[model samples]
Target: MNILAIESSCDDTSASVLSGDRILSNVIASQSVHIKFGGVVPELASRAHQQTISQTVEQALEEAGISLSDLDAVAVTQGPGLMGSLLVGVCFTKGLALANDLPIIGVNHMDAHIYANFIEHQPEFPLISLTVSGGHTQLELVREPFDHEILGKTRDDAAGEAFDKIGKVLGLPYPAGPEIDKLSKQGDPDFHDFPQALLHEGLDFSFSGLKTSVLYYTQDQTNDFLEEHKADICASVSKAISEVLIKKLERAVDQTGVKTVVLSGGVSANSMLRAKTEEMANRKGLNWYAPHISYCTDNAAMIAITAKFMAQRGRYADLEMRPFASV
Candidate 1:
């Protein structure tokens, strides 16, 4: 079946066309207005989505060599994101469904992240997924397709959030996770040992303490000192976060006895985290999977692929369905 998917759960307005499990095209319109604000502004994001969603979808369809009438169903991210931003996609999708007499599939943003790995790889069942993003950090046990048991999640700030917050203290740009990852490659991870909160605790994670630690650590240093050791600081912080995430994932694997492990969400794009996950999986003789970098961040291809699974299960949404802000 051919599917048209829209993703506007955050600052990006994206659309994708999928046939079976293959993505023909994935188009994203990112809003630069939030860069100066250091984070996404809900109002601005919704406005940008409204402005670009139509054209984004058009581009996706054109690239796919198909039109709206040829689509079998329309899918969209329904929740676990900004309400206004979600509404832009949800309402727009509803209109298309109504006009073309097509079925509407409502997808969870987090769920889409997990399934994004399926776009290129066929991971075995009964797997553990470590989903790390700016808004969430979670360990999910998937016993089968679309069957997820959240093993643990962040009690406070997520891993990606920690990266950005700490990066800001180091005077990096907004959405600084990628920046930190790049700089860490050239520095020493052992330069400074940042606290890894709840490292020995339960499956739940915490990064708030780490954020505060970076804040205080930077305050005590002069600008020249910070500039001189910026890469080291970034490397150390990345080490702390990656250690906590990998440790928790290891615990989940032991507790669940799952041989296959997958990583998803925006933070999964980090080079250090990917390498650490691969190393741990190899040491344990387990299977490891992660999405291509294109699917790591927010995108409609994940939504389209996830919707294909949902469609198989006869999960469909009606016009009365409304957008939600949380899971």
Candidate 2:
């Protein structure tokens, strides 16, 4: 089956084409307007999506060497993202489906992240997934396709969000996760012991306290002091987040007795987390899976792959379906 997928869950407007299990093209247009604000501005993001969605989809179809009439189904991210952003994709997709008289599928953004692993590495059933993104951080138990049990989720800020917020504190650019990850490579994670929140808690994650700790630590430092210690701060902060995530994931593995574990979402791009998780998985003799760096962040390829699974289960949606902002 040929499926076209659209993902505008947040700041990036992306489209992908999948012919059966094979991805033909994945196109994304990222919005840079949020950088000045140090975060995504929802209204501006919505507007950007409006302007880019059509062209993005067109480019994807062209790159895939297909026409709208060649598509068998249309899939779109339906929720757990900015409402306006979600609406743009959903509405545009509905129009496309209507125009082509094609079947439509509504996919959960978080679920798409997990299925991203399917794009390259298909994990066995009953595996564990640690999905960390700017808006969410959660541990899920995957029993089967489309069957997800959220084991634990962030109580406040997500791990990726914490990275960006802390990066902002360090006078880094917006969407600071990548910046922090890059800087952490040059400094010592032991330079300062940033607090790791809820380390003793169960599987649930917490990063608000860590962000607060960074805030308080930098509040009294001079600009010169911050400049000198920036790399160390980034390294220490990265270490703190990575430790908490790995600890909780380890706990989940012990409790569930699942031997296959995977990492998903945007934060899966972090080198430290990837390395540490690989080590833990090796130490425990467990199978570990992570998507290629390109698939680690939001993209339509994951969404299209997810739609392929939904298609197998006959999980198509009607045009009347509405987008949601939360899972």
Candidate 3:
């Protein structure tokens, strides 16, 4: 079946065309209005989606060498994102589905992230997924397709949130996770020790304390000191976050004995975390999987792939369905 998927759960307006598990085209238009704000503004995101979603879907279909009439179903992110942003995709999809007489498949943003690993890699069942993003950090146990048991999640700030918050404290740009990752490669991870909260605790994670620590630490330093050791600071912060994530993943593997482990979500694009995950999996002789960088963040390809699975099971959404803000 050919599916057209839309994702507007956050600042990005993306659309994708998929046939079965293969993505023909994935188009994402990100909003730059939030850059100066140092974080996403829900209203601005909604407006941006409204402005670009139509063209994004058009580009996706054109690139896929198909039109709306060729699509078998229309899929969209239904929840776990900004309400206004979700509404833009959901409503737009509903209109398209209604006009084209196509079935509408509602997808969970978080679920899409996990299933993104399946886009190119066929991970076996009974797997553990570490999903880290700006809005969420979670450990999920998937015993089978579409069956997920959340082992743990962040109680406060997520790993990506911590990266951005800390980056702001260091005077970097907004959405600073990628920036921090790039700088960390040239610096020393052991230059400064940052606290890893709840490192020995249960499966749950916490990065709020770490953000606070970075804030206070930077306050005590001079401007010259910060500029001189910016790379080291980023490296040290990345080390602390990656160590905590790997440690928790190890605990989950020991507790569940799952041989297959997957990483997903925006923060999964972190080079250090990806390397650490590979190292840990190799040492334990386990299978590891992650999506291509294109699918790591909010993209419609993941939603389209996930909807393919749901469609196979005859799952479809009603025209009256509404968008939600959380899982």
Candidate 4:
């Protein structure tokens, strides 16, 4: 089945066309406006989605060599994202489905990230999944193709949020995770020791304290101090964050005895996360799956294919599903 998907749950305005599990075309229009503010502005994000979603969908359809009428179903992200962003996609998708008389599927933003593993590669059932992104960090045991029992998740700010907060303290650009990942490779990973917040059982993570650690470390420091240790600090902070995650992943694997581990979401693009994950998986004789850097962040292809997965299960949502602004 051909699925038309839209993802505007955050700063990215994206559209994609998928045939079965294969993505025919995916177009993402990221908002540069957020860069000027050092963070995402929800009000502005919804407005941007309204302006760009139409063109993005058109582009995706063009690239896929199909029109809206040719689509079997329309899929849209319904929650766990910016309300303004989510509404733009939901409302637009609902209107399109009504106009074309097509079925609509509501996809969870986080679940779409998990299914990202299915788009590029398929692993055996009962695998451990670690989803790291700007808004979420979770460890789940995906026992079946569509069933996810969340094991551990962030109790406060997510890992990507730490990157942005630290980036602000370090005077880097908005969306700091990628910037930190790119720069950390050039310096020492052990320059400074940052605290790792170990939470209670069930895989709950907390990055709020870590973000505060960076804040306190840079407190009362001159610009020269920051400039001199920029790379090292990036390496240090990246090191601390990655270390905590790998430790948790190792525990998850051991606890579940699942040899297959899949990584998804935005922060999964971190070089340290990738390197450490590979090392950890290899040493344990387990299989690890991570999507390409581009797909690690938000995009519509994941949503489209996830919708296809749901369709096979006879799972579809009506227009009643609502949009949320925050976690």
Off by over 4 Å in 4: 199-202, 325-327
Minimum summed lDDT over a 10-residue window in model 2 is located at 118-127
The list of candidate 1 runs beyond 4 A from truth reads: none
TM-score of each: 0.99, 0.99, 0.99, 0.96
State the TM-score for model 3: 0.99
> For candidate 4, lDDT tens digit of each residue in 265-297?
998888889899999999999999988777889
lDDT of 2: 0.94
Writing each residue's lDDT as its tens digit, candidate 2 over 56-167 gives 9999999999998898999999998999999999999999999889999999999999999999887899899999999899999999997889999999999999999999
TM-score (C-alpha) between model 2 and the true structure: 0.99
In model 2, how large is the Cα lDDT of residue 204? 90
Q: In candidate 4, residue 164 scores what lDDT?
A: 92
lDDT of 4 at 198: 89
Q: Across residues 1-327, which tens digit of lDDT does each residue of candidate 3 receive?
A: 999999999999999999866799999999999999999999999999999998999999999998878889999999899999999999999999988899999999999999999899999999999999999999999998789999999999999999999999888999999999999998899999999999999899999999998899999999999999999999999999999999999999999999999999999999999999999999999999999999999999999999998998998998998999988
Q: What is the C-alpha lDDT of each candidate?
A: 0.95, 0.94, 0.95, 0.89
What digit string (tens of lDDT, one per residue) describes model 1 on residues 9-55? 99999999999768999999999999899999999999999999999
lDDT of 2 at 254: 99
Which stretch of 10 consecutive residues in model 3 shows the poorest summed lDDT? 15-24
**Structure candidate 3, residue pairs in collision:** none
